[model samples]
Target: MGRHRRGARREVTVADLIDALRRYPADMEVRLATQPRMPQEHSIGAIAEADGLVWIGEGRQEGYASDGVAERLGWR
Candidate 1:
């Protein structure tokens, strides 16, 4: 038997994150950092604080029920 190797993790980009939220309209937790850092597999952070939204955290998953976030992002 051969051992399985993990595939390369997908690096989520800022634009991808915006598009996902815009198109999917699903409740998702986001992570934000004050400075530039390594990218995540499926997360994004605001480049500036003025962006208005707060970053959740890494390895944190939460349910997004109401479409509030979608409406806030103008995706609704």
Candidate 2:
């Protein structure tokens, strides 16, 4: 994938995300990853849409990811 465009954002539709996930094995875990510099993962929680925006809950932080995650995410 290309490097993330600075300050660029793309709105992903539920169908779009689902289609992408369909390629993965069903037993794989799903989590939210953010704070790229620190590289942590969180549990996936409730998903809802309000005010024309869909929100995915950022569940509790599970733990810091291994060094590989930062490299994979191209955050370094």
Candidate 3:
């Protein structure tokens, strides 16, 4: 995933996510990668579509991500 470094913020929509996910297997497990400096992760606990938007809940903490995660994410 690339960062938006200019112009108005274009929020990622459910459609966008779906389109991207099409390249992967439907049964693939999804996890949240967060805190780039610390590189933490979490399981996906919930997903809901409401109020015209999709919500992805950052589930339970799965501990620090591998060292390469931060570098790959350009979060360092």
* Residue-by-residue lDDT tens digits, candidate 3, 1-76: 2337764457886677789889999999877898766888899978988889888888899888887777766676
Clashing pairs in 3: none
- The digit string of per-residue lDDT tens for model 1 on 2-76 reads 112464456555666677668654675454222123222334533443356544444432334235444443345
lDDT of each: 0.43, 0.81, 0.79
lDDT of 1 at 65: 27
lDDT of 2 by residue, 1-57 (tens): 222478566677777788888999999999777888888999988889899988999
Sorted on TM-score, best first, the list reads: 2, 3, 1
- Scored against the true structure, residue 40 in model 2 reaches a CA lDDT of 91
For candidate 3, the clash count comes to 0
Model 1: residues with Cα > 4 Å off, grouped in runs: 1-6, 25-76
* Model 1 TM: 0.25
Q: In angstroms, how far off is 68's CA in candidate 2?
A: 1.2
TM-score per prediction, in order, is 0.25, 0.77, 0.74
Q: What's the CA RMSD of model 1 in angstroms?
A: 13.8
Top candidate when judged by lDDT against the true structure: 2
Q: Which 10 consecutive residues of model 2 have the lowest summed lDDT?
A: 1-10
Per-residue error at 46 for model 2, in Å?
1.0
